[model samples]
Target: MSSGVEADIALDAAVVLSLGMNRVLGRTAGLAGRGAEALAALAAGRAEARAAALAEAESYDQALRQVLERNARIEALAETREKLDAEVALPEPLRPEEQPIEELTAWCAATDQALDGAERRLSERLAAQVAAEIFAVPGGAEGLRADLGAPAPEPTENETYANETYRTLERVLARLLPDATADDRTAVAEAARLLAGIGSPEEAEGVITEVRLRVGEANRRTEELRARERRRAAERDAAEQAEAERQYVLGSITSAFEEMGYEVQDGFETLTAGEEGAVVLSRGSWPDHSVRLRVDDAAQVRAAMVRTAPARSEDDRRLDVEREREWCEAFEAARERLGEAGVRSEVTWRLAPGVRELPVSDGARQTGTRSAQRERSREREK
Candidate 1:
């Protein structure tokens, strides 16, 4: 009995120990699994935190750009509203029904156009100002220190076009004309004021001086050109007047020659181009001599014809006078081209009327025609 009791106590103690061991083993396994899961969750949380930080950093550039764009839009809207008000006047008396409906409609349209234009201008200006602040002021000061007109500071790649164009302009101008005159120096200083649309005293002086010089030269050239034109016009008038007189004389000479029954000689027209309209003349009855007209063709021919005076037919004297008339026309045409005083030549002729002489020739078409016409006239008269 004592042995059985001892064995039972030992067995009970072994079972209790096994149960406790099994519980401890199960608890240790569960704790290990839970620890692994906690480690995985910690790693994921650290990664998520890092990703969030990266996203925030990336967004800053976009945010800053947005703020600048918003500021520009606000300024543009404000300027547009003001501009529209300025351009379109309200109805007179500021009262209803005082203005025409058409005028009111036009005003509204003008106001809207003005607003649009102003908005565009303001947008452009705001963009410029913002860019200037960010780029021009700082970059320009650096340039000023680096001999102002030297090659520009190197630009950051893709870092906006900002002041690059202005910098490039200065660098190009510096190279294009390295050495400058007083005028060039003045141009440079004035260029800034002009670009900015600011009325500067120094710039204004340069402009005024340049304008004065140009205006003075313009006035002088204009006066000289005008004087030359006037002289040419006067000469033309005188020449035309002389030509008129010459034509008159030539007409008279032609009529007188035909009437006098004197056959016209060739080379007569050639002599008309000469000074004083003189030509050499000779005939079967007259000695060779020079003849010209004083008042051109008309006066000379009229003198020769002497309309009121009865014609005296003498072949010798008539031939001499006819030769002189041809020469005068030649002289006048020459004088017109050269525009100089013509040399005088002595040419003489005697005039005779048409009635005293009669001739019969196969060559004289006028003689036949005149005779026929005279017969016709006689018949009519009868």
Candidate 2:
């Protein structure tokens, strides 16, 4: 139960919780977060513009209403005048100043002109107002709720609802209490969940906070109990990585042996570790020349096999085979040319499934012999 291990476990739990929350937030917000962020930088200037547009729109609407009211009044007055013409007796036209029809017609025309101008201004103002509203949607934290496509996180009831709340509360509690055992944390989570769904947020927060503290304490205690487990797990992982790296190194060495025609078997005979599952595989015939091979545990080997596929692509494999064949071909050509220098040599170029070797049987000319004209060709072919 070391402190380092406990700290690592707590940190791991925190990382896991953070990743999950990030994904949840990402899914809920879409790209509105970017827009929300952009709005804040320009809010001050934009707020003034928005206010001006809104004020202009209200002024226009008021103007429009006033024009309509005035027009209605004029029309009503005209109707009254018409009724008066029919109901009351009027003298025959005689005085030059008593030109009622002309005056009434002129008054109607002037009111109509004013009404038209007011209506046009109102229309323009409404368009500006619409633009302002679009530009002035609440942003930052306010925008977050809109961006979530959520209903502002209302509390709920019912078993299913409560369960969801419990899970959410559990996550928060887990973040708050990284060291607690899973079971103890779950208990705290359930209590917090119940509190979340109850009526009144003030009361809910008060109740949940207590449960959260209790959960945190339990989580911390559980962490202490599991300290040994965490330490052992870390050690196991370190050992595995070290072992994997060593196995790769050995494979590299075997590759060098195989190039010299030694028929290197790599893990074929368990040459290095000499643990269980080691084999006595022989390559050369009769009074055989053999190389011992050893390897990590089979579980480690299998995991490596499954994981190593991604290190190469089909195209890479194809190119590698082409390159190897060219090398072997040049080596074979070099051996043939070596005989011309009063040097007789026997060389074989070969490749096989799961193995490849090029053995030269020239005892005297073996020194740096693979280097003669080796820059040009190798005989190994697919």
Report every candidate's CA lDDT. Answer: 0.35, 0.35
Q: Per-residue CA lDDT of candidate 1, range 35-108, in tens?
A: 23332343455656434533432333233323333333344355443642323222221122223435544554
lDDT of 2 by residue, 34-148 (tens): 2222223224347655445444333333343343345444443344335323222212222122223345345445766754544333323322222233324343122112121
Query: Which residue segments of model 1 deviate by more than 4 Å?
Result: 1-203, 266-382
- TM-score of every candidate: 0.25, 0.23
The TM-score obtained by model 2 is 0.23
**Best of the candidates, lDDT:** 2
- Model 2 clashing-pair count: 19
RMSD of 1: 50.7
Candidate with top TM-score is 1
